[model samples]
Target: MNDLIPLISSSINDTLASLSHFYAEIILAAGFLLVILADLFLSRRFTQLCFLISLSTLLLLGVQSVILLNTKTVFLFGGMLKLDHTSILFKLLFCFSSLLFAIFIRYNSPLQKHVKGTGDLFAILLATLLGMNLLAMSMNLLMVYISIEMVSLGSYLMVSYISADKAQTESAMKYALFGAVCSAIMLYGISLLYGFTGTLNFNDPAFINALKNVSGLSSGVAISLVFIGVAFKLSIAPLHFWAPDVYEGAPTPVTAFLSTAPKIAGFAILIGLLPVFQSEGGQTNTQYFDFNVILAVLATASMLIGNFTAIWQNNVKRMLAYSSIGHTGFMLMALFAFQGSGFQALIFYMAVYIVMNMAAFLIVDEIEEQTGILLIDEYKGMGKSNAMLMTTFVIVLVSLTGLPPTVGFTAKFLVFSSAFEAYRNTDSAVILIMIITAAISTLVSLFYYFKIPLNAFLRNSQIQVMAPGNSPKAYLGLLLAILLLVLIVFPSVIVKLI
Candidate 1:
């Protein structure tokens, strides 16, 4: 009994030590609390207080993350959490995304016209950021479940906040209900995994080693079941039914944030989990499951479905949503090819994706604000009157289509090349399929992405147009678009970092 007491005390001390490594996340949580309080008491007096607080909080968090970049450390609160480079990268991305989101909300939230409590929106965003950061570090299945639900709940609230129409409300309702069901299923999967392995840490080397020893069917069910929640977050094909509707119905900025940040987090979690499936005694351990083939098939399906479905979307935001899914497929391809240098390529693609999507949505919101139009056809003759904005929009769309001399093209090339390398090394049929499918989908994407330029430049409209409003924020967004344009030519700027 005395020996057990000392062991218990030692475990407690180790846990506390690990918690210190996550000081950045702790600070973020505190910021979230402070934002809520300031929103309630200080927002009325200081118009921009909530925004300032949120932005400052994320900025500081970003700094904190950068400080820990080269450190490799993991701490488990009794085997529930793990922190390391992977989690740090995820948190950094979340911080950058949150900052962009705040800028987006300030400039053009769809709810701005009708909503009174944007302060709540910022707070929810912070809360979601907190969850995603935790998700990157989660090793336990229960921790994974909790972190995912936390982010999902925050996302639903953000979507429903100050919704202007029945459609938006309906979208939020669908999201909440669907997300709840997915969470419940994932919880069950976690329970099964815990029961099978008697441990919850997916990243714990020993835990995963134990899990692999389980019955073949049990391991497959456990892994596939856990992937359900991630697939939902990623908007992958089978679980992607909610994406277009949610993206179309949510405010444009929210749509942009939703499409990018959470997807990146999900990918990080996937990266953390994939190596665990590389069972010992060769890759043919189980007849019913081949992890690589499953991911490859999902990638193929996501690319095909996302690109083809996008071809049918007239609403700009909806098209971007499907496009985001297609991008997810591309990222999955990277996931397949992931090794030492793959991290660089993945970060490069995600950064460029965020810039492109944010800029595209900003333009959507700007056009809507000026012309009160949301359809692609409504963009007719916009090129002539809104020449500057349309020019910026064309650049962004071209990048999205992955044309030459664009950052998107560079990102795709790296991913494709890496996959090709993986194929050469292994000659895996699955890798070949993924590469070919992704290439074809890129071509398919070109058809719809070009529609933006076609409508703006070639099509004509009878309606007269007015000058764009004098908003500096719009110019800033255009400047951001220009930055992406520059990134295409100067890809090394971001590529060298990761």
Candidate 2:
């Protein structure tokens, strides 16, 4: 008891010192509280005040994150959280995506009309953003599970917050149940790993040595179980069954947030875990099991399943949900093939993806608002009526398909080049297979992505669709699409930032 008193005092002092490095997260936490209070107290008179506060909070948090970009890596909370350039970049990304999501929710009629109000939704976003920030920086298994559940619970609440119909409620239930199961499996896996290593820090030398001494089959099973939670968040391969229904049923803004921020956060967590599969000298440590082959197989399966299944979907949101899965596979390839420049390439690809996806969904929401049509077939003959909007949508889709004169092409080129470089260095057949699968998936994506333009321009529809108003959503989509073109010509802009 005497010894424990000093230890606890020292620990508290260390934590207080660590708080200096955690200002951005602190601000976000405070913002979450303030937003909730405002929602409860002032929402009756100032309906849009919550939206304004949410946007401001995200903007300020983004600025705070950017300021920390050049700071040295700092491990806080006794190595539970790691603050580095990569984590800062990811945090900024989440903040930016959350900003856009706030705007999207403000403009969304369905969400605005909900009885519960959007203020709670903003609070949920802040919570999820905090979770993702923690996820990006987590180094301890306990921190990982806590951060993941933070994001998952916030996501579940966001989906069900404005449940106006049966579909929305059903989607929430499915997401919550599946997420709970995955979390449980992940917790069990963590316990197994802890039992094996007697430690939870993956970066610890003792943990690696312990894992190396375990049976390959045992370690593999434990690792695979842990990956189930990540796969559920990434919507990769067989674990992606919940995505389509959730995306199709949730509010468009919620779907936008779900597709961009959380998915990237999953990648952030995966990147943090990459060291588990590597040695101190940066070589693949295959003593326990070959993660390369497992990841390669998962990537291939996700690409094939997501892209091929997308072709048959009539609903645009469902189709994009599948496409998000394919993108996850591609990002997984980037992680697997990470070499000298792979990290930069992966971050750039993710940034471009967020831009393209948000723009695409914004356009989809606009079209849905104007015409009350959600089916791709319903877009027939509407091109001539909404020429500018349709043109922007086509450009966004073209970017999504990784075509020329767009940032998507540049992003894909960087990832492919990184993979090729890794293949050359390691002579790994799995990398080669992943590259081939990615190329094929890109081509497969074209058929569905082009369907939007084809239905709008080529096919003739009997129903008279009204032209979309000059709303903020349309302008936001146009701005994002234009940014894609700018990024293509100035790829160095993002590259330098990284």
TM-scores of the models, in the order given: 0.95, 0.97
Question: Candidate 1, residues 112-160: lDDT per residue as tens digits?
Answer: 5544857888889988998898888887777777888889988999888
Q: Which stretches of candidate 2 lie over 4 Å from their true place?
A: 277-288
Candidate 2 per-residue lDDT, tens place, 1-498, comes to: 786886998899889989999999899999999999999999999999899888888989988887778889898988889999889999988988888899999999888988888889899899899999999999999999999999999999999988889999999999999999998998898898899899999878899888777777777788888888888999899899999999999888889999999999889888887766443222244545677777888998999999999999999999999999999898887775575778888999999999999999999999898888899988999898899899999999999999998999999998899888888888988779889989999999999999999999999888777774668999999999999999998999888779
Give, for candidate 2, the lowest lDDT window spanning 10 residues. Answer: 278-287
lDDT of each: 0.82, 0.89
RMSD of each candidate relative to the true structure: 1.9, 1.8
In candidate 1, position 350 carries an lDDT of 86
Model 1 bad stretches (over 4 Å): 1-4, 76-79, 277-285
Candidate closest to the true structure, highest lDDT: 2
